[model samples]
Target chain A: MTHATLALLTLAACAPAERGRTLVIAAYTTPREVLSEQLLPAFREDWRRRHGEEVRFETSYQGSGSQSRAVAAGLEADVVWLSLEPDVERLVGAGLVTGDWRGTPTGGLASSSVAVIGVREGNPLQLHSWADLEREGVEVLTPNVRTSGGAMWGVMAIAGAADRRGADPLRALGATLARVRVMDKGARESMLSFEKGVGDAIITYENEVVVARRAGVPLDYAVPAQTIRIENPAAVVDAYADRHGTRDLAEALVAFLGEAPQQEVMGRYGLRPVREGVDCPDLPALSEVFTVRDLGGWEAVQGRIFADGALYDQALSLSRGQR
Target chain B: MSVRWGLAGWAITAGVALWVGALVALPLAAVGAEALHRGPGPALAAVLHPDALRALALSASLATWVAAVNTVGGLAVAWALVRWDFPGRRLLAAAVDLPFAVPTLVVGVLFVALLGPNTTLGRALEAAGLRVVYAWPGMAVALCFVTLPFVVRAVEPVLAELDPAEQEAARTLGATRWQVWSRVVIPPLIPPLVAGGGQSLARALGEFGAMAVVSGNVPRETLVASVYVLGEVEAGQVGDAAAVSLVLLALAAAAQLAGRRAGRWLGAA
Candidate 1:
C-alpha cells in the first residue's frame, strides 16, 4: 500500500508538465467569478486551437491590494489583472514587470467602470448624486482605503465630484465618510454588508452593481453625473513568465483580453469595454467622468488623501469624535 | 551499540531537530529578523506608533473581556455537564464544541446573519440604542465564539475526574453547598481554569478572520492588531507589518507565561 501510494503521488506530480503548459493568473476577487465562468473557458478553447495542445490555468483571487503584494512577494503569477494602476506599479517596483506596461497593448487597459452608489431596490433613500450620501442619517458602506484599491478610487471619485461642485473637497469627503456605517476590508465584502442590510447604500464599482443585478440580487445603483472612471489594467509578470518559459502564452492571453470578442464577453460580465465602439447596455450613461490623471495621477492622490496621517486619517479622527 | 544502530539514532535525532527548526524556530526567527531589519529604533517606533498602540490596547482589552467571560461561562457549562443528569445533557455538551468545528470566517458570517442591521433582532437592538455589528462589541462576540472551546475542553476532563466524595465529606461536616463549593471544589479547579483562560486569551489576541469580517477595520476604533498588520501589508509596508506582528507574538508569549506562572503559584499555595 505504501509503495502504491508513493507511485501515485509521483505520477500526479509529473502529470501536469507532461500534459501541457500551465498559466497562472493572479487577479483581484471581484472579477474572478466572471473570469473563471465566462472568460477563461473561451481563452482556453482559443489557446488550444492555436497551439494544438491543452493549456491549464491556475488562478488566485484576493483583494486587489493584497493580491498585488502577493505577486510582488513571489506568488509566481504569469499574468496579473488588478483593479488599479498602483497595484501593478508595485510589480514594477519589485522588478517583476519590465518596461512601461501601461503603454502596452490597448494601453494596458482591459476594462473600465466607474464608481456608483449601490442602493436598495426602488431607491427608497432617493439617493441620486454624491451629495445625497452626506445627508443626515444616510449611512454609507465602503471598503477601507488602505486595504482596497477600489475604495481609494471611490474616495477619489467623491473628492472629484466635490471639486466639480465647487465644494470644499476635504469637508465633503469628511462628511460622507462620517456617515459610513462600516468599512469592510474589500469592495465585495462591503457589498455583502449592504446586501445584509448593514447600510443605506454602498460606494462601489459600477461593474459590481451590474454584476449583482445580473445575479438577480435586489439592488439598484445610480451613476452620478460626475464620477471617477475606474480602469482595470492587465499585464504579464515578465519575471515569472520568463522563469516559467511561458512568456509567449502570457503575452498572448493579455493581448487576447483586448481583442473584440473577449472585450464583448467582458462587457457582458458588466465591465465596460476598452474599445470605444462596444457598448454594454447595462452600463448607465455618464455626464462627466474624471480619471486618476485629473487628480494629478495616483501618486498625487495617494500622497494627498490615502497616505498614512494624510487627509483620510485626519478626517477619520475628526469624525470619530463626532460619532 | 553497533555503528548501524548509531547511524539510525543519529538519523532519528536529525529528523526531530529538522522538524522543530522548520516548523517553529524558523518562522519566529524570520519575523524577528525582518522586524529589526531597519534597526531596533525604527522597529520600536513602528510598534509604538499611535494607531498601533491603540490597536494593541483594544485587542488586549477585548481579549481580557473574552477570557473573563469564557472562564465563568465555561466553568458553569462544564459543571452542569458533569454534575447533572438531564434531558439533552449529552447534546448540550456536544454543542459546546461547535465553535471548534465551524470555521472562524463562517462564525463571523453567522454573527452577521443573526445580528446585522437588516435582521429583526438587529433592528430591535438598534432601536434600543445598542449596535452590535461593526462595533467593538461585535469583535468581542466573534472572539468569544472562536475561543469558546478552549476553556470548556480544558476544564471538563478535570471536573469529570474530580472526586464527589470530597464535597460529600464537606457536606457531612455540616457545610452548606456554597461553603462546600468554595472550600473544596473551587480550589482544585484553579490551575486548569487559569491554563484554559490563558489559551483562550492567546487565541483571541491572534484571531483575525472572524474579527476582520465583523470589526469594520476602522482606524483606531474597530481595527485590531492582526487586521492592522494586514492593512500595513496591503499598503506595501512589509517592515511595518513584521514589526507589528512581532509585537503581537511578544504579547501572546508574555500573557501565556504570566498566566502559567500565576496558576502554578496559586496551585502551590
Candidate 2:
C-alpha cells in the first residue's frame, strides 16, 4: 500500500504542472530583441503577480511582409506587432483577427517613430534635408520598398516632403533613389550595411539610430524639418487567442503595453509614445509630420505608388535608364 | 517470362511514388499552375518587365562568368592537388570544399567583412575607384565563392584516375610539357569540366542568400532573378513571383540537361 501511494505521488509529480498558456507574438525583426529582452520579462512578471500562474512566450521575427503572410497562412499567432498597418489589415482580411484592432489602442497605435538620416560619426556630406540625399557623390543606403514596411515609409517621407515643398514628388523621389548605392531587403539589413560603411548616409528609423548609438557605434542622425510619422500597431489576434483560450491574457498584454510604464520603456528603446505627454528626449521633434493617411491611406498608397507600372516602378525604370 | 512485382513490392513502389509526387511534383505543379492561371498575357508581362528582364540578364551573365572562372581555376587547383606534392596541398584541397559546407549567407557576410567599406582593403578599393561591396564585381566574387567547390570536386576524381604514364610517354617522345598537356590531359578533362561548369552555372542562377547581401539588389544593376522573385512575393504579388520562379526553374533545368548531355557525349568519345 505504501509503494502504491508513493508511485501515485511520483506519477503526479512527474506530470506537468497545470497547463500554462503560451502567447506567440509575430513581430518585425527590429523590435524583436527589445521585445524578448525587456518587454516580455516585465509582462511575464506582471502576469504572474496578477493571475498567480506562469506564462510563456514565443516570438517569430521576420521582415514585416513575410511575418504578415505567415500569420495569414495560419501561423496561429496570439498577437502581432508588425511594422505597418497593411500587415495587420492582411490578417483582418484573412479572418484571423475579427475585431476592430485599429480602434482598440490609443489612436490605433502602440508606438511611433519617424524617418531620419543616419550619417557617419562626422557628417561629411553636411546632409540636413531630404534634398541633400540627391546631391552629387552622396550615396544613400535604403531598403527595397517592396519588401520592407519601413522602406516604404522612408520613400513616402521623401516624396511627401517634396510635394509639400511644391516639387514633383516622382522626380524628387527618382533623384533620391538614383543616389541609393545599396538597397537592402529591410530596414535592419540596411542598417547592417550602413554599419559596414556601405554608404555615406542611410535613411532609416530614428529609433534605429538611437539603438546604434547606445551600442557605441559612432553615428549621428538628422531629422529633417518634414518627415513622416511611423506608427507601429499591436493587436490581439482574436481568432487564435479565442481558440487557445488565451483571449483575456492577450487583451491584457496589449493593454499593458499602452500603459505609461511600458510606453516609457518603448521610448527608451527609441519608439515615440502613442499617448501624449510622455516625454522621450531621445526622439527628435519635427516641424511637419505626416502619416499614411495623408497619402490616401494604405490602400490608395498601394495602388498609386506601389502597384504595377506605378509611380515607383516608373521612377525606378527612369533611374535605371539614367545609369 | 515477364518479371513482375508482388503485392508488397507494388505497394512499396506506390508509396514511394506518392511521397515524391506530393513533396516535389506538387509544388512544381503549383508554381506552373499559378504562373499560367492568369493566362499568358500577365505571365509574359511580368517576365518582360524591365526590372525582371534586367535581373534575368544580370544573373545569366554573372553565372556564365562564374562558370568560366571556376572551370579554369578549378582545373588548375585539381591538377596541382593530383599531380604534385606540396606543403599545405591537403589543406588547400579541403578548403576548396569549404564553400559547399558553409552556409551561403555566411559566405556573403565573410565577403562583406573582408571587403566592406569599413575594412582597409575595401577603403583602398574604394579610393582606387573600384567598388566591390555593392557592385557587379562583388556579385561575381560571391557567385565564385559559393560555386567554387562544384568544379574542383567534379574534376579532382577524374584527374586522379588519369594515367601519368601517358604524359611520361609523350615526354619521352620529345613532346614539350605544353604539347603533352594540350593533347592528352585536355581531352579527358573536358568532359568533367563541362559537367562541373554546368553545375556551377545552375547553382549561380538560383543563388539568393549570398547575392542578397553582397549585390545590394539595385533594381537595374545588382538585383538578380531570385531577389526579384522575393521582392514580388513580399509585395504580395504571388502570381508574378510564381511566374518569375518558373522561368528560373526552366533555365536551371535546361542547364542541367545540357550538362548531362555534354558529359555523355564527351564520355562516349
Candidate number with greatest TM-score:
2
For each candidate, the alpha-carbon lDDT, in order, equals 0.87, 0.87
User: Which ranges of candidate 2 are over 4 A from the true structure?
Assistant: A1-19, B1-27, B171-179, B266-269
Docking class of 1: medium
Please estimate how well model 2 matches the true structure, expressed as its whole-model Cα lDDT. 0.87
Compose the digit string of candidate 1's lDDT tens values, residues B1-269. 69999999999999999999999999999999999999999889888877788888889999999999998988988889999999999999889889989889898888988888888989999999887988888889889889988888878898999899988999999999999988888887888789889988988998988987888777777789998998888877888889999989988888787778877788778
For candidate 1, chain B by itself scores a TM value of 0.93
Fraction of true A-B contacts recovered by candidate 1: 0.80
lDDT of 1 at B114: 89
Q: Interface RMSD values for the candidates, listed in order? A: 1.6, 1.4
Task: Give candidate 2's chain B TM-score.
Answer: 0.92
